[model samples]
Structures are given as C-alpha cells and as structure tokens.
Target chain A: MLMIKTVLHFDSVSFRYPKQEKGPLIYDSMKFTVREGEFVSILGPSGAGKSTLFRLITGLEQPTGGKILLNGEYFSNRLGHVGYMPQQDLLMPWRTIWENAALPLQIKGSKQADMRISVEELLKEFGLGGHEDRYPAELSGGMRQRVSFLRTILTGSQVLLLDEPFSALDAITRLSMQEWLLKQWEKRKKTILFITHDVNEALFLSERIFVLTDPPVSRMEDIPVPLDRPRTLKALDIPEIMVLKDRLIDQLRTKATT
Target chain B: MKKWREHTYSFILLVVVLVLWEAIAFNIKMTFILPSPTDILMKLWELKKVLLLEHLPATLCIILIGLGISIILGVGLAISMNSSKIIEKAFYPLIIFSQMIPTIALAPIFILWFGYSIWSKVLVTVLITFFPITINTYDGLRAGSNDLKELLLTMGAKKKDVFLLVNVPSAMPHFFSGLKVAVTLSVIGAAIGEWLGAQAGLGYFSRRMMTQFDGAGVFAPIIVLSAMGIMLFLLVKWVENKTLMWRKSE
Candidate 1:
C-alpha cells in the first residue's frame, strides 16, 4: 500500500487573543497532522478551544507563533483555503436553497449559467433536488443543514471544518445526518475536520479522533478506530468501540472537573 | 372573515358617532359651529372638483416626491453609518437633535427660504419622514449575523459582497417597518408645510374655508387629508408584505 500525503500540518503553533495580551494562552506549541482523504473528528468539551483551532485554520484569527501548512505550503492568509460550516446554518432568510448554495460561486464571480449547473448538481446529490426554490423558513432543520453543507462543499477547498453542524437537531435527525455526512465524505474523498463534543458521534463517523483534553492545549491525543468501513449504527456496540467511547468520556469528565 | 368582522365593527361605531353629531347639530341649527355629517358630505361633493383635481394632487405630489427623496437619503445615511464608526458617531446624535427641533419651528425657515414653491413643502416632508427609515435601517444593518459575515469572509468574500448578500437583505424587514412609519409622517409634514404657506394644497384650502366660516368646507378638506394619509399608509404596508413574505411565515 502507498503512503498518504499530509494535506495539513501544524508546526508547533502558539496563540493568545490579541486584545488579551496578558491573558492565558489558548494554544501552546500545538502540533498535528491530517493526512489526505481523512475524516478526523476533533473531540473536546466546550471552552477547550476547539472552535479557536478552526478559526486559526480559517485565518479568522492568527497564531502568534508557528507555521500552518495547507497542501504542504504555508500561507499567512488561509481564508478561502478551507471550507467552514459554522454552528448555526446561517442561511440567508431572503435567499432560496439554490441561491444559498450558490453563494461561494457568486463570491468567486462565476457566471450565472455556470452557477446554475454546479448548484443544481449538488442540490440533487444532497437530496434537496426539488426543494431548490423554497425559502429557509419553509424547510425543516435537517434540510436546512443539508443546504448549508452544500454551500460548504461549493467553497471548492480540499479541507473542510465543520463546527458541530448538527448539535441543534433532534436525536433522530442527527443520527441520519451523521450517516449521510459520512457517505458524502467518502464519495467526495475530501479531508474533513469535524468538531463535536459527542464521543459516540466522533466514534461513529470519523476514522480517527483528536481529543483536545484541555487548553492552553499543547497537544491532541491521536487515536485510530478499530472499526471496519461502511459502518452501521449497530457497530457502535462493538466491545473495542465501547472502550474507546468510555475513554473519550473520561477525558471530557476530567476537563469538566478541572 | 375575521377582517370583515373588524371592518363591520368600525363602520357601526362611525355611523353611531355621525348620527349623534347630526342630532345635536339639527337641534342647535348652527352649521358653522357644528356641521352635521350630511352637511360635510355635501360640501365635500361641491369642492370635489377643486380638491381632487388641484389642491389634493398638489399635496399628494409633495408627499410622494418628498417620500421618494427621503428614502434615498435615509438608506444612504444608514449605509454610511454602518460602513464607518466615525460617521455613525458624528451623525447619530445630530439626527436625534434634529428631531427635537419641531417641524413647527423648522417650517418657518423652509417657507422663508423656498417661499410658496413646492420645495418648502417637500423639505418639511423629508424632515419628518427620513428619521424612522435612517434609525431602523441602521439597526437592521447591525442586526445581521456576524457568523454569516465570517462564513462569507472565509469563502473569500470581499466587504462589498458581505454587505450586499448579508447586510442589505437582513435589513429589509427593518427598512420596511421604517418606511411604513415614514409614509404616515409624510402626510403630516406636507400639511404643516402647506399650513405655513402654499399656493394650492388641502391645508391651504382648509385655512381659507375656516376664515370664511364655512365649517363644512373645512371639515371636507380635513376628511380628504385623513383619507390620503390612510391610503399612503396602506400602500406602504402592501409593498412590505409583498417584499417580505418570508417574515409573515415565521
């Protein structure tokens, strides 16, 4: 088997909020690597700087020290280098499903005709084929998340950062959304960095889990799942998977106590 | 059906008030001091040619023209304030202070400057109408999601794109609400401007009728003005409903 290329690399990154110069650092000499075509979940409790990591990668915030490499190259400005799906769907109430999905293309100044084709194809693949004309208010929560995910994919970036995309959905919907997301990831073969607090969700979806135990986070524990491909929800009950789930919860509990 | 019920209730209340006024006026036999509803109606019919054809049109023109200008000015100011903190700080207090300066006081200055020309009336209408639009649009611009703005930024969006896609669309509901308020105030502005000085307008017509002790004549123009105000208000509401159908569903 051939070795996979490293699509993203963080070289001893350090960061603290600019305004809070004297405040505690959020990240200190943090280093990690995500290989190509990986579905890696960043699992941490709230306030563990899970979002700060994504923000740094997206270039919304800068790291005071360290190098961030995308595709084995460092760029000071990382905006547009990666796809990001925020916590809220953040759909424009005025825009219809197709229009919302076409936003990244519009920003890139794609022709209207070109936008029509790309958005149409993606809408169908995302199971939103006939709902393109509907406003955000008309769609259910799960459907809205799909539209948002379509928009994220249209950014045309190799790496995607999803910040708890289904935290607000009902349990039933969230489970389906996870399975659907995993299918999309496999089909597209893009590197995905999913942020979630749910240990079981991390186990169910990602090939590997990066547990952010605490911040100022110096390191993340990289652990591989022992599960096979094309996972069913029933696979969650496997003895090894259950042990990993318990271990993740234990890490989160330790953070909570501190 | 519920709306029809509301209209019937309003109609009955109006008829009851008018019948009571007619009974009192009939007993006193004084058309000047207290004109009956029928007397006012007859006077309105007699003056229809003048009010509808000339003075009514004049006032409506001032309102519509002033309203159009005010909308352009208001949206411009709101956008400027949103784009720059300095502009917002400088103009915000000035706008509030300007409102404190009553139209009764400002009307004289405009009349002195523009004389009896339509400009003076339009100026007054702009003064009255633009406030709501400016304040509401400013608030609406700020009300858009920061997350949305950031999302766009991460997608390589320019400031212009963020403004057009997120800020402008999000501000629509507030802008429409402000417009409804502005349109209603516009009628009042035109009347005040005309009251101070004008060649032809409903306010001028009413004043002239009052001096001649034609009570029903004064009442006639007042009714026309009130009806004009209602029509303009309803027109704004209809446009708002059409533009923001999404708002109605949520």
Candidate 2:
C-alpha cells in the first residue's frame, strides 16, 4: 500500500504588485513544501514578502511564474481548499461571538443544525464555549485571536494559511497562544504555512523554519527544528538550537546589511 | 475616565439649557414667539395625543417612505459605482451637481411634478436624504481594507460574497452615519415639501396657523415638527446602536 502525503508544493513562484517599475519582487522563484500535518513558518523582515507568500499560497495573487499544488492537485482548480487567518482578528463586529465563529460555515452555506454541534465543540476546544452569545468587541485581544483561529479551523480546509496570526497580542498572551496553537495543530493535523516576523515564535511553533530576506525574496535558510513535541522554553535553551538561532540571526543581519 | 467625563459633561449641559430657558421665562413673562421650556412642555402635554398620536404618524410615514427610498437608491447607486469605474466616473459629476442644486429649490419642482400630495413630500424627503447615503456608502465600499479583502479572496469567497459580507458590513458604519444625517434630512425634506404645497401636515398646519396669526398655534406645530425630527433621529440612532454595539465593545 502506497502511503499518500497531503502536501503543498510550491515551484518557482514569482510575483509583484501592480505599477512597480523596479524593486525587490515580493516573490522570486520561491519554492517550498509543507507535508501533511507539518507546521512551516516563513520568517523574514517587514518587506520580505512573508505576507505575500501567504497571499500567493492562498490564491490571493497569481504567481507570475510557477505551479502550486496541494495533495497533488493544482491550486488553481480547487475551491475552498485553504483557510486564511489574517493578523487582525477580522471578526465581524455586528456578529455575536458564536456567529463570528460560525461565519465560515455560514459563508460556505452549511446548514445550521449541522454547524451547531461542530461549532460548539470548536468553541469548547478553544476555551470560548460560553462566549457564544457575546459580540467580538466584548472579547479581549487574546480571546478574539483565539476565536479567529477557531474560525479558520472550522473552515475544514486541509491547508491553513496564517499571516502574523499572533502579532497583535501582548508578549504574555502571544506566548500562551503559541502553546495553544501548537496543541490544536497537533490534534487537527492540517498542513500549515504560518507567516511571522518573530524568530522565537518561528522556532517555537515551526517544524521547519524558512528564513527570508526582503523581496528579491529567496529562502535564506531552511532549518529543521529537532525539538520534541509540546516544546517548552527550556528546550529552546538547548546548545544546538541556540547555535542554529545565532546562525539564522546572523544570516538575517547579513541580508539587512546588503 | 475620559469617556465617563464626556457623558457627564453633555448631560450637565442639557440640564443647564433647560434650566436657563425656564428661569428666564419666569423672570420676564415671554410670549409664544419664543416659547419657554415650561410653555413648550405644557403645550406638549396638552397636545401629545393629537400631535404625537395623529399628525406625528402622518409625518412619520412620509419620513419613513422617503428615508427608505433614499437608502435603496443610495446603496443601489453605490453598488453600481463600485462595480464599474465608468459608472462612477459618469455619475460622480451628476451626484455633485445634484447636491449643488438646493433641495429647497427642488421642493417646488417636486410639488409641480407630484402635486400637493404625500408623494411630493416624499419626493422632497428623498432628494434631501439620498446624497449623504450615496456618498457615505460609496466611500465606505471603496475604502474597504485591502487586508480583509485579500483574506476573503484567499478563503475562496466569490465577488458577491465579498460585497454582501465584507464590503457591505464594513461600510455599515459609514452607511449608518449617512442614515443619521438622512434621518434629520427626511423630516426637514418632508416639511419643506409640504411648505411648497400640501393638503395636511405639520408644514401645512404651521402655514394655516401663521395665516391666522395664531403665534401659539404656529409654535405648537413647529415644536411638534422638531419633536418628530428628534424622535426619528433618536430612532435611527437607536438602530445604529443596536447594529453597531460591537464598535463600542471594541
């Protein structure tokens, strides 16, 4: 029996925004793959096209050249294959917390009776069970971010594209959210390509980290993290991981200098 | 603390105005030309049933009908402009020109076309009310956040879904703000239309009372018109609050 791998394969993807004469292209021959249930973080500087990577992978922009495939199927042909969570909570202020959580299902034209139980389970899983009736404004930033995550998960897409999902939260909240997200990712086991600027966060959550420079953006280094599951702050204190971090940091610094 | 102070200060200012009006009236007996707070209150109490219960409903019907038409046309035009740059380019000039054409001047045209009927009043209300709604909705729709839109596009939301869900809801605050202006405009528009030509309304009643030189009578209906305007304004505000409570919580 051949074991099938649900993977996102990017080959030579290139793109630029409208009306730009010459600048670092957001993507230039970018290529990578996220296997089933793998968490891959793309770490780069502010203008490094990390955000654009999410855009390209999620079909927001058509790459000037390249092919993108998810589970051996072309991205162009698929419908509703990937779920995207933006930096902002993006919860509709008019909707109740429950309604906001249920928005993906609502948009997909799912039936109320069916979505209720699934949404209930998801809210409980994300520790937002009782917040069903409350509006998005009533929730704290951390809580709203958690709800946004749940909304992404509820979409039932195999591939999840998250753009700076925890960038808005405070340090303490972001720490906790990273742990929570890791645990959820473990259970749900979807292929995730998360974009973030934080080196520590990329190291903490990603199975593999792709460090990127500012556009003319190519992968600086694709470092595999050998840390154990449910990685703790203590694990990050390991000598080899520290050395790898220093190396990654130095590469980013050299890119910045050039 | 800052929010609380704002609320408290506004409340105090309202009480001060009412107190001053009542106090000066007591000091020097004033006529109905500038009715005192007390006199207005007394008149309101006596005629509440007749004004609020009867004539107020008539005025309200014109306002609601006019306001509804404005929203539909404004939102419809906004959607059209959003979809086609050419349509926006074509109508942008016309919308500005229409705004320049004074609503007061157009009231008589409405009367001439629709006659001295409720239709004329409604037409006038629509003319006054439509512009704000259109401008606000257009700006709101056009000024939608790129990040949110990109996110939706990636999520495989179709164009219609983006418009109905993201664009429309995002523009809602702007739309309601426009509605707030239109709410006041509708009342004024209806009255102004009636001012030009009408069978029965507060405007017609005010004219009749003015002809008789019954200052109190004229004052009475004017007060009622103001009260009606306030009611409609508050009603729109209440709806705004209910719909946009999330903004406050945010």
Give the top-scoring candidate (lDDT).
Answer: 1
RMSD of 1: 1.4
Model 1 off-target regions past 4 Å? A1-3
Q: How well is candidate 1 docked (DockQ)?
A: 0.75
Instruction: Output the lDDT of residue B227, model 2.
Output: 78
Q: What is candidate 2's lDDT per residue for B133-207, written digit by digit as tens? A: 999999989777777666666666788887887888888899989999988878788777777877677777777
DockQ of every predicted complex: 0.75, 0.56
Which lDDT tens digits does candidate 2 get at residues A1-258? Answer: 976585888778777875674644777787777788889998877766677677677776677778888787885744467888988988877778878888778778889888878888878878988988888878899999998888888778888888898897889999999998888888887888888877788889999998887677655468899898878978888999899888878877776677
DockQ of 2: 0.56
The lDDT, on a scale of 0 to 1, for candidate 2 is 0.81
Residue pairs clashing, model 2: none
Q: Model 1 scores what on Cα lDDT?
A: 0.92
Interface RMSD of each: 1.1, 1.9
